[model samples]
Target: MSKYKCIIFDCDGVLVDSEPTSIQVLVDIANAYGANIDLDYGMKHFKGSFFVACKQMIADLTQRELPDDLEAIYRVRSFEAFEKKMEAVDGVRDVIGNLNLPFCVASSGPESKIKLNLGLAGLLPFFKGKIFSCYALKKWKPDPAVFLWAAKTMGFKPEECLVVEDSLSGVRAAKAGGFDVFGYTAHDPENELQTLATKTFSKMDDLLALINNEMA
Candidate 1:
């Protein structure tokens, strides 16, 4: 039997290769609004956060309040970028297909953005009704509430669920919620996630093997 009853995935960098593109969009938006931020800075500071957090970070960095429509602008630009560049993480589909346990996406992103990116990457069918968003829960990552909610709603206890995450905040949230977390490190050159995750993997195949081994 699988050790985990369900696998919860963080949508952005884990399932879809959308983090670089999304962070680039954030950098461009911040620059356009007079913030002297770059992709590296944005990725380091904002990789796991949502729009609200991003806005606050920009405000603090630039020492200026963002335009009232900043979030709207970000959504538009991010969707456009995603439409043009989003792709599923290599081999993630195969891993999902081969898994016997149930799985779902729980993300800091709003439901609409999650749906848009997943649909664009053709990973939506795998998740469908299994998508959970912080927007709906009104609690974001690093808070643990969203992860805990996903566990309960999916009919699994915290210890019965495993979280696959690519961000530090996501890993922290999963741990805080009492779930074992596997961190994806393919995109994180800084190795920030490894310390927070129960285990870390650079490839989807490796993650699959780890899961299978754990269950065995």
Candidate 2:
């Protein structure tokens, strides 16, 4: 009895527990560049943003020019960390496995990073060709083009899709793209998503019932 025909999932926090490792890597790199950000700052500003935006913010924060290989460096460190510790979000596999509807992952990362993280987390098999990346179009969340593309390619109108996202940028993207969004709040420490998302849940185990309008 769900209204949506397709589900568009945000990969990092929603599918794989990737934000912490990724943000830690970003923090380490930013610190090396003379920036003073900690993990919390990284999560707040860098979590859902694309590389260009992140780079500009770093420059602003440090007031110093970043190395040309800044992104490359971060990628190397983050991927290594992911390989060692990345895992799917708790109970996510159960929700994904039991869903009767179509689903796909649309992320702010490049296609390669998306695949790597999902693969490392053992969730890639479910996504395969169903993954969509903002890098494909050079547009990231808060722009909404990526989510719109996912819905269109999945053969659903924007209104017929539900976007499950964990970040402010992703939530803004989904809402702007005309989709109903369910905010996964485990990563939402500031409760910023509470007022923005169409619905919100703190646990992945609650998602299946939530999507089907059967949650108690």
Candidate 3:
């Protein structure tokens, strides 16, 4: 049997390469406002939180309050681009499909946003209805409430679950939730995730090996 009965995946960098679409949407809005914002900031602060990034971007460049409709605008544009170009992370399907343990997604994004990205990547069907978003839990990630919620909803305990994540914030969330965590570094350099992760893997085959080993 697998060490854990269930696995929870973070959606963005873990299952899909949606950053390009996200970054482009942010840049498109910045251009509309004639604001000069660095793309690096988008990659860093903006990866997990949609509204936070919108407000921060306005503050960073224009030194002004974010427009009331900016969030809506960004959402619409992001979905448009996401539908066009989001691609599943390499090896995600093979690993997820072959895993013997039950799994679901616990993401820091809004539920609608998570569904959109998953649908775009064609990974939605794999998750069925097991997608849990941070927005529904009354707290966002780096807090662990979302993961805890997923575990509870799945009738599992934190210790009975394994979390696969790609970001420092996500690792912190999984740790806080008291779950075993495997940090994925496929989308980032080892140095980027090593400090936050207990163990890291650059490919899904390696992760499958570890999972199967744990089961064995």
Candidate 4:
């Protein structure tokens, strides 16, 4: 059987199908400001990155100073898009329902955003009081703090938890914190997650088996 005692989920792409919606909003807003990026470019470079990171990239792309409210505009627009378009990752509800282990979310999003997205996806109840946000720590992914905090709060060592992540930053953070992470590759266009994660799978339906050591 898999030795994991707890699961740490990344909220955006893993739990709620919000990455594309979120990134699309960023691309649209950035393009309006002359970033000139397409959806594919946003998905590749911005997925899992902090807003500041994406903002700096947009500034670099436009070769000019951006509005101070870039993030504010993004939050408002992205949440609006999410309200209309966000859904739970396919088969995630079933996995969360059937999995017989402890689990929680650790995301780079603000707690309000995480809760809003999860609530929209009908996943809020499963994660109530168990959500950890990097914003809460003023730390972003590739820093390991969020995952470390989640594992500790969930009462598991890093080695005893499996982090389900769909972003490069999330995978890197989990690994750096001494946790095994499964890269969820459903939206991956470049097949990058497989190279960095302990194991990579594309569907949530397969997760129960993967966690239970039923998949070889």
Model 1, range 137-184, lDDT digits (tens) per residue?
A: 789988898889888889999999999999889999999889999999
The digit string of per-residue lDDT tens for model 4 on 80-171 reads 99998889989999999998989999999999999999999999999988999999999999999999999999999998899999999999
Best by lDDT: 4
Error of 4 at 92 (Å): 0.2
lDDT of 2 at 184: 96
Against the true structure, candidate 2 reaches a TM-score of: 0.97
**Distance from true location, Cα of 188 in model 3, Å:** 2.6
Q: What lDDT tens digits, residue by residue, belong to model 3 across residues 1-216? A: 667899899998888888767876786677567667666666665666646645675677766666888878888888888877888898898898888888999987889988888888889999888999877866877899999999999989999999999877888889988988899876564367787676788887788888766752
Residue range with the least summed lDDT across 10 consecutive positions in model 2:
207-216
Model 3 accuracy (lDDT, Cα): 0.81
Q: Rank the candidates by lDDT, best first.
A: 4, 2, 1, 3
Q: State the lDDT of candidate 2 residue by residue for 105-147, as single tens digits.
A: 9999989999999998899999988999999998888999999
Clashing pairs in 2: none
Q: Model 1, 24: alpha-carbon shift in Å?
A: 0.7
Candidate with better lDDT, 3 vs 4: 4
Report lDDT per candidate: 0.89, 0.92, 0.81, 0.92
List pairs with backbone clashes in candidate 4: none
lDDT (Cα, 0-100) at 197 in candidate 4: 95
RMSD values, in order shown: 1.1, 1.7, 2.1, 1.5
Clash number by candidate, in order: 0, 0, 0, 0
